[model samples]
Target: MPREVMIHPLAPAGEPIPLVLVAHGSRDPRAQASTRALARGVAAARPGLDVRSAFLELAEPTPAQVLSALRAGGAPAPIVVPVLLTRAYHGRVDLPAQVAGFDCAIADTLGTVSEPLLAGLVRRLREACPEYDAVVLAAAGTSVASGRATVAGVAAELGRRLGVPCEVAYASAGGPGGADAVAALRAAGARRVAAAAYFLAPGRLYDTVMSDALQAGAVGAAAPLGAARELVRLVLAAADAAAPQLALTAA
Candidate 1:
């Protein structure tokens, strides 16, 4: 867990602080584009607020670059929001190291189980498969045990919400892949099984998982949470919780 930083609701007496979203960058251009789209959504949702996107690796505009530009522009210490779904290596180690020298407060990860995030998953799943007896929540795998536990929690909550059995699967790293999960659900006598993408953006991993799920008899696979309204709200909420006084009202 990250150390809590005390922020007085009335201390910052100036313009709204900038929000820098730091993502675990990918080599795929689609992933980068999706991150930029989310940043635009944040800025559009809150006019006059400075919203920027940075990457931990494999993409342009690293955290250091963004923070340096902000410092040069005389902007106050900003909140660095990690656009990560789980508190894995990237959130717990990589992100902290990347933004270590910056005079900025780090907010919590988007997390595995949040109301807005769950809703986004459901919305995407429904759009992909209107009817399914079972679902598979496919995530970009993490080696951290705690991170895997959180993914399971999210799967349980999603199952409860959708009134269907949901299992957690991984696209890489360790754990059951999408095909295995789908096959397991079928073996348990499920007629239709669909996959709900637990990714913030589209990339090769996502494509591979969806393909495997479909090949394993999944009905359909939902798209990633790219610029979804629910996701935009979640980002704003994270920013608000980090800096109360500079919280941008969600649209």
Candidate 2:
């Protein structure tokens, strides 16, 4: 009793489809710079592929602006990849509303617990502290239950991969902040606790969490996963998977 789905070529004769990486925008300059860097990395990985970066809010060149420019340049409907790690508010509502008028295929949000993404987290954590017995996956918390669940899942998997107990902490919204999480881990008999930033770019929330963690006796905190090689791979994979759907939608 299910409908069948058809996949089509991205263009009339298999022309290259533009990929737009949409990030949760921030007012912080570092956030914008980090996103632009990610766009560059994606562009570099696929030599001739068109890769563009746009923000959903609090940043320049919104998704609509990017799509309009692409249309003006005679490019076909693009595959919009939400560079989000979870299907939170931005991914679920804001992004869809932003691109509603555009004839583009909206790809799935880059999930939290992808292998490459976990690998990137490990890489960043290790780079921050060579040895740590425990970690706290600090995230910009969301009130949505599903989003919180995804973040918790990421924490468990990350802990398993690192062979340490990882706890989930929030930087904003409603939850235990980074300091409290670090304190809990310490009281739970974790000798050396580190905070792994569950963010795609450097922003106010990330800064606050990292600072709080460090102040609360965390050995060190990993930086945001900005322009990391693993992230680049994930972005490309998302675009490729959505290309056919985008073509179908455009048809």
Candidate 3:
């Protein structure tokens, strides 16, 4: 039996552009699943648009492979949107190297601090536990100075939003780890400390933060920003911003 193609009512009249969302791959299957789920959400929101997910490594369909396939399929003007949370090494160096010869435009990495992201954090924190005296923003740390700065800025912004002091902690590579941060809060007489997952997916880093922080006296740890509607909107917004870049590339 032939299936009828159902067009989305809100779909644009003309051919929609393809969006290649490239995520930092993980060894944990949940990371890949969450990445795909986020892409699915974006595709659902903008029905006619071609939204695809690819990884950096430790996963199938690397970004290069996806881009090559898109080029071979005669995609005239596709764009690559990094599913990364910050403009760190991956976004600054690796992604460009991957799409070097490809004609597709690359959108900006999702910034550290945004209204939608803040709301997502609040939602996750509330779901994890009740109001706490302190919060720690747990991130996958990087040696890059700018990357650390980005996380710090986000922690500050989150603190403002929650009207509570929020400290930045690292899961790998850099400074005060989740356990350390939580312990500091506990030592300072904080009866209840919550750690917010300043990450995109569930993986080794996130798991470490949750487990270690709780062991170090944190009351709870929020879930990763997986498949959040706000994240989907951010991805789509990134793609739209790059639409004009296609014209510039053609020129």
For TM-score, the strongest prediction is 2
RMSD of each: 5.7, 5.3, 4.7
Which pairs clash in model 1? Answer: none
- Residue range 125-205, candidate 1, lDDT tens digits: 999899999999998898899999888999999999988899888989876999999999999999899999999999988
How many Å off is the CA of 169 in candidate 3?
1.2
Whole-model lDDT values for every prediction: 0.86, 0.87, 0.83
Model 1 worst lDDT run, 10 consecutive residues: 1-10
**Model 3 residue 101 CA deviation in Å:** 0.1
Which one wins by TM-score: 1 or 2? Answer: 2
Top candidate when judged by lDDT against the true structure: 2
Per-residue CA lDDT of candidate 3, range 159-205, in tens?
Answer: 89888778888888856888899888777777889999889999998
Report the alpha-carbon TM-score of model 2 versus the true structure: 0.94
Tens digits of per-residue lDDT for model 2, 1-251:
11212222357657678889999989898998998899998877776678899999898899999999999999978889999988989999999999998889888888657888898999998899888989999998899889999999999999999888899989888768988999999999999999998999998999888888999999998989999998987887787788778656656
Q: Which regions of candidate 3 fall more than 4 Å away from where they truly are?
A: 1-14
Candidate 2, residue 73: how far the Cα is off, in Å: 1.2
